[model samples]
Target chain A: MGLAERRRILELQQTILPERERELADICGRAIPYAVDWDTFADDAEALSLLEYSACHRVAMALRVVCRDALGREAVREGLREVAIANVADTSAMALTFEGGVLRLRGAWGQRSAGMFGDAEIGALLSARL
Target chain B: MRILLIALLASTAWYGASRMRGASATRRALRELGHVAVPRRLADREPEERDGLALFAFGRVPGSPQYMGSTTPYAERLVVAAWTPTTRAEAADRALRTVALGVEGLTWEADAGGDAVAVGTGTYEANMARRPAWVLVRDDSARGLTFAYMAWRRDASREAALRTLERVAGSFAPALPTAEYLALARARGGVR
Candidate 1:
């Protein structure tokens, strides 16, 4: 692209990005307070592109923490899947479920990704939510 | 009626006092940031200061190349943000893990440091690439964590990227302690 064109693109990006960050931060902050900082995590085009992907992953992870602390894995998984279905596409192989407020990991993918959340994260989640 | 008026006056005074304190903190932080060079464009938004954690952006002029006659924008454009988590030790532990995960690919590189770099009062990690011109630095201090990432379309030198990162990082000045950041983070109201 030409300089003027690239400059235009950059200008457009500059205008849109901060608004997008604020919107996303607001959405994430609703469920996880400190999650607002996630908006700051992305600094450029590449990072901005990855922002949505990482954010989904982090929110999913935060939900797992919430499940472990509150209802259980299955409920959290079910809740996650519901939210995912409503908001995401093509999550067929994803594994995370809860039964009786207890979390269970099934499938190879599920087992490998287990135990990702910890106390501080959970605290961050609670601090944001509560 | 008189009692109600008195109560309203008291509440208004308290609110005014609280706002004054917040403004004072923000001014102090801005004063501290005097050493940091923030591009005029991004600095226009003003810093979003909550307790000691501040978030803002800085970069080469939106469209101008990093250097004159460069034909293209700086191979590395960065937006830097610094925050001091309310729960310092606890937040730092989690932040360390978060930064580690964030730079997983960089960590695997042969030249990557085996661990974080320890400077006077901070720990830093950098991910650098020679081609495509990208560099990311994640620095942690008693205050909190500062993240700077830059990626360019062309081959940019590591030194250039690091310089931009440092320039932005050096500009952030935190005024509150961890306890204060925590109090702000945990405050009942959310940041707008």
Candidate 2:
């Protein structure tokens, strides 16, 4: 694909990440009133809060993906290493970390991070040998 | 109302596309994925808590199962859709196809974790037709599960939801490690 096409694809990919957050937001929003009123349901608030935090972490990663230039692949890969300092959950047990621009999981996010900014399962399902 | 209508139209497209994407996601249990979730992994955890509960994960929340391109960007890896979101209305099927995949569907949910607020969920319906979908399913069973779980609000219902999850996931267990996992598995044993 040409640079223009790549950019468009990347843009579309970025566009979709937000929808996940929105859907989760929508799902949680439905129960706030009941949660606040019910003493035992207080856990509801915490669950939503944690989900929000987790969503933010993903948003940050997506931002970094959008920022990278295709030619500077190595730099982008290094950029991912720095992400370890971010609030990302440890992904070390899931996969291999390769030297090229892509962050192949030696130990990935392990939860569901198939991609740095996407699903981790495809990498597994497709045997996406990074 | 006009925008809602348009949005509804868009949602229907998405649903149709998702259903058409996978060739075989019926009530079949995937033997390939058995490696991902070890019998040991299930065994190690306490059965009481783990029972009647399971996790739904895909490379992307709504990613097409079609193995497009030799190598898709890492961002399109897997989706962790906790529940199968689906619809009966033709409009919903259309909407499902229009919306793209979301990657972080799984991160926020843990059975016993967190502070959460159940915000309102919007539906693309005209009162008579509705679907509570986050991701469109490839088959009827997945759609049915999503419909039921989306309606739950109480503890008993949530427990039921959990059981439903286990049943649905039981149909797709041994979550295979993606190629990504395969490499990681090989490297770990490689000389340090």
Candidate 3:
């Protein structure tokens, strides 16, 4: 990766990172009523390489939303269980699972057949099901 | 006979000096991780050297099997491991991979001061059974280090296990003149 290529990747990351964070925050805000903290880890190399070539990535991001207090934890847990149960047939870019009381949301943007789960759609699904 | 006696005396002095140097390094490393003093119930076990880090176990819970890189003997174990400077995300990812058997859920916290903590549950791969475990990952980026503390219990109650974990986590005191412990406490929402 030359300076120009590195710059391109950096610029692309700068553009997409905040958007992803906002999208995730919006989804969580609408889904859970409590004060939630977001922790995210992304394998940016693959995402950036794919985005540079085809504007898509197989694994875009993995998010862990932690609800600290007991009430908040319980609320997130119940909401995740309900969403998982209700959306058994739904195939989207995002997958939601509850593990050890934390909510995990993973996104794969390369799967064009399975449409991306926009914040509004996710929020609606969560709000309706939760 | 005189030459042999001198050689023996010199060898003994050299060994003593090297041991002193090793002890000093160990103390400094422990202090860097905010362990001012070893807890009463715990004894320092030989550190395990890995690829780029060292895992230090500092306690032996009664009746627990001896496992390298694991102090997962319920309420009385403190395992601290440190890594070279790295991003919090990378450090955390590596720490979890290195320390825990299998991380189920993680609760991450960070303060403006760049101190971060990841608390989570896992299983302790022990002799008889896989025991429930708690792992705490403390990120000290300023010092170019990441520390992981793990504890596991044989009992069944998760609540009690968590309490014991917190108690053990709180027992570590900060090295003098550094407020890293306070920062960690704040990030963890005063878990102690």
Ranking by DockQ: 2, 1, 3
Which regions of candidate 1 deviate over 4 angstroms? A1-130, B1-35, B40-55, B59-131, B153-156
In model 1, how large is the Cα lDDT of residue A6?
Answer: 49
TM-score for candidate 3, please give it. Answer: 0.31
C-alpha lDDT (0 to 100) for residue B168 of candidate 3: 43
True-contact fraction per candidate equals 0.00, 0.00, 0.00
Task: Output the lDDT of residue A1, model 2.
Answer: 33
Residues A31-109, model 1: lDDT tens digits: 2111122222122332323322233333444453455543444333333222211111123533334333223221221
Candidate 3 chain B: 10-residue stretch with minimal lDDT: B23-32
Q: Looking at model 2 chain B, report the run of 10 residues with the lowest lDDT sum.
A: B40-49
Model 3 clashing residue pairs (backbone):
none
Model 2 regions lying over 4 Å from their true place: A1-64, A67-69, A84-130, B1-91, B95-166, B169-192
Could you estimate the TM-score for every candidate? 0.31, 0.20, 0.31
lDDT tens readout by residue for model 2, A1-130? 3454344334323542344334323432211110011122122332222222232333333333333444333333333232111122344433333233233322222243232333233223212322
